[model samples]
Target: MINRRDALRASGLATFGALALGAVDAGLTPAEATASGQLRGWTPLPDPAAGGVTSPPFPKNLTAEERRNLKTFDELDFTVFSSADWARLDESHAKHVRVHWPDGHYTDGIQKHIDDLAALFVWAPDTNIQVHPLRVAKGNLTAVTGVMRGTFSAPMPDGKGGYIEPTGRQYAINMATVGLWNRRGTMDEEFLFWDNQTFYSQIGL
Candidate 1:
């Protein structure tokens, strides 16, 4: 004795239940499955420890300035970008810092830079960046290259104050940043470069 709307609702719920069970079997939580979609045909890689492979230690023999810059960069990446700890912004940037992106847009103050970075999480809450193998520091400049990876699992803000719907697509794009640290041991300027076209294509935008 179900009406058409009731029958449709029941069918949708049954389908969702099946998908959730499948996601659980694939080692994903229900929430992850809801955000990341059904990861069909995906398999987790074997553990590296099983093959006697271990990660190497951090680089050594850096000058005092180089080491300090590296530490600051690591703090900025792990604390601010990856962990979303916005309060640590001052730890890496000066009060009047300027951040320039590849798109010719720039943020003037430390707070504005922090706000720009924070907005990314509104679109992709799980965004993370990892620097690998290419850290270099000399004098007042520090440069690092890494991959920024995230899933577009939330609405994105459009310029007109409306939001575009979530795409549920994940992306990993290579990016590089160069920072100029002042005598105060905080970056006074930073330049960031990344490919916007590749990002857009990967996110299905």
Candidate 2:
């Protein structure tokens, strides 16, 4: 006379009891026992780099140009945002590259973009970003989505000849960028988009 919900609840309680018993017998806490692989029928998550069975594979039939564009995009994200290697901008961006921000402001050239990023890093030295989970490249265009995480532990510019004191708060915001590549395998135009309100709320601004 057991309903499906009751049966599921009973099964869950039984499983928890077994786990608790196993933990006590092994002289460990329940959490420690679970983490130590005591849970029956539990499978560890597969390595993302190994492209597990559940992961959708990238297109294997990409053209040479498309592959090059994708590689360049990855390098750009690593060097420019993750690694903060401003000097290497030439490797992935044209000298005349233009970068557009969500606020409708745009950097005219690579040097200008470097200056803008430098000021940002001054505000948040621990800034680190990674592009992943969603990357697409076709012909001379590439798009990537990821999160930018950092701690606001330094004074920030107020754009009015003054500075705002550090808040020491951390923020992570989802962002996306689309790039128009040139024939030289470097980005000529990049458009970045993110929710400004979410970012400001997270940092208590």
Q: Would you list the C-alpha lDDT of every candidate in the order shown?
A: 0.69, 0.66
lDDT of 1 by residue, 76-174 (tens): 785677999988889889999988786767789988988898899999999987543345555566656566789999999997999999999998876
Worst 10 residues of 1 by lDDT: 48-57
Q: In model 1, where do residues sit more than 4 Å from their true spots?
A: 1-61
RMSD per candidate (Å) reads 20.0, 16.0
lDDT value for model 1: 0.69
The prediction achieving the highest TM-score against the true structure is: 1
Q: Write the per-residue lDDT of candidate 2 for residues 1-205, one digit (tens) a residue.
A: 7342333234433432443344335433222335666765334544322333231223345568867877776676655666788998888889999887877777888999888877878878888765354455555655555567788899998999999998999887776676778888888877777779988887779
Worst 10 residues of 2 by lDDT: 48-57
Q: How many pairs of residues collide in model 1?
A: 0
Clashes of 2: 0
Residue 121 error, candidate 2, Å: 0.6
